[model samples]
Target: MLGGKTPSEFMKLPIEERENILRGYLVTDDDVQIEEGDDFGLFNKEIATGSLLQQEYFMGEDEAGKQLVKEARQIYYRENTFSVRSHWLCEFICDTLADGKPIPIESLVQRIIVRVDVEDIYDMDDDMVDFMPEGEKEKSWVVRDLRQLLEFTNAEFIRIEVSGRGALDGSDPQTQEKIKEISGIVKTLIEQFGEKLTIRKLTQLNDGQSIFHDLRSWLMLE
Candidate 1:
């Protein structure tokens, strides 16, 4: 139109003329309006090559913006699935009695520590145990030689808000009761073996509060 030519012919002009054509397209000599999200209509090859070549026109405004929106959504939900999962393990430990026989002190300690470590895999928050990932092997419990693993879990939970969050607290007091249960196991072991059930390095992170928070942090970091 700017060069006394049709829209198709005008497209044959150089890049500078292409800009002029776009300017003419935007202005309406009479009355014209275009709404967003409406089809732009089939474009001629030359016009498409020249006008649509610009990033904003051809790609639209939302290409990169949509990716960022998706990423934010992903970030928002990254830890939720795991959070729902870690609780089942806690329930299992709390609800199940160890074959009606007392859980050995070292064994009980080992189970609790391993459980705490497992919680770290799903969540980043202080309270919350993440569900295990699909087909992943759970860490072994150090029931036999409970020195290093127990201490490591104990220390890690402490650093990750053991007092604020861990298996030591719950609404039903099951976690605490479990501790006493474990202590009893230790006590019995002490009587049977004629040796002190002294855990010199690792101290349990229970403080009479819900420890889901502690477990969540541990698993999330993991």
Candidate 2:
């Protein structure tokens, strides 16, 4: 058997044993392009090609469908849920943008594209029918535009932080200094956002749960 023996010992064993003990190795050459300077041939080839070509095609279709679903969901949530659609929340977002804060698109998407209390929503509306749009849901043009604007605003904040007069060592700094400056900017943005944006408190008990509870009660009556 290959056992725990070294390479020499494994070699001494039978061919089958040696094969069992063999681990893969990679031999690199000096001419190999291992860095950014290396050639990166580019073409607009579709993703997931080869035998999985169908899967690739399906990916775009599925993505488009998902986007539609998200748009429908946001519209529904905005119309129905006070907890999600409070004036305070909108102001918070506006203030964050105004204060030149940089928030990631992925993070924002995750926050909006979820139903925190689907069960609660259902229980509140006994006659409610959960009907989704046929085919995959696509994102609304409005949401897409808003997201783009936020991303652009974030980029501006990043630029200001890196190149502003307040920046002690602005441009052409060493890698270490650049990293430190960026970290400081991120921290400042976080602090500004926290000061303005307050999370909506959602409790299981309906008693005295903000004005939203009253809204839900009225919705239930209607």
Candidate 3:
């Protein structure tokens, strides 16, 4: 039905409706066809060509326009494999954070929250596993490194809450040491990336408790 319409008619439709139609057409195998003189192929080259032309026209020919079309293609064509998505998100994080501008917490959470994994951040062996039966194959590895967690998750601001009864009272030696280690890692990250990375330690008027929080909560104010 969409293919039968002229470009002007199609452009007259609501943008959301047009997008839905394009998404369906991009992934459906039924759209492909062959003429009497056409060569054999997995999909209809003519349809694919037309789809790309439409995307280019709608998205424009600038760098940002190309990226928009690419992202749309990835979604509509089912070309966004896990690895591809992770890599793109990682690059986006690096570029955005490196720009020295304040980033919206909501955008970070919505875009990168559950989509990324430990493997996407670290260079680990595919077969690495914590445990396996004597004759069984290795399972997937888990995320054990705090640095990888901070970097991959794009958590630049971290809060360490320490409980104590008085100003003189402080955290235990082990907790203090661990906090120092984490602070060192954060400092290294800031040195490498920029001053956008920060960590804060808060002393609460209590004991026997410690908590960590991220700046994601600020999204509420935003």
Question: Against the true structure, whose TM-score is highest?
Answer: 3
lDDT of 1 by residue, 1-222 (tens): 235553334445675655544544332232121122223423222222322322232222455423322222222222111111112333322311222322222222211222222222332332221344545222332112222223222121211111223233221343333333234333333344332122211224447333233222222222
Q: Ten-residue segment with the worst summed lDDT in candidate 1?
A: 77-86
Candidate 1 regions with alpha-carbon error over 4 angstroms: 1-62, 74-173, 177-222
Error of 2 at 92 (Å): 21
* Candidate 2 local lDDT, 1-222, one digit each (tens): 125543334345665443322211111111111122212211112110211111223222355333322332232222221112211223323322112333223222212211122111111122222242445222222222222223322221211111111112222233223233223323344355432222111223246432211111111222
Candidate with the larger lDDT of 1 and 3: 3
**Top-lDDT structure, candidate number:** 3
**What is candidate 3's lDDT per residue for 3-26, written digit by digit as tens?**
666555555677677667666545
Tell me the deviation in Å of residue 180 in model 2: 3.1
- The C-alpha lDDT values of all candidates are 0.28, 0.24, 0.37
lDDT of 1: 0.28
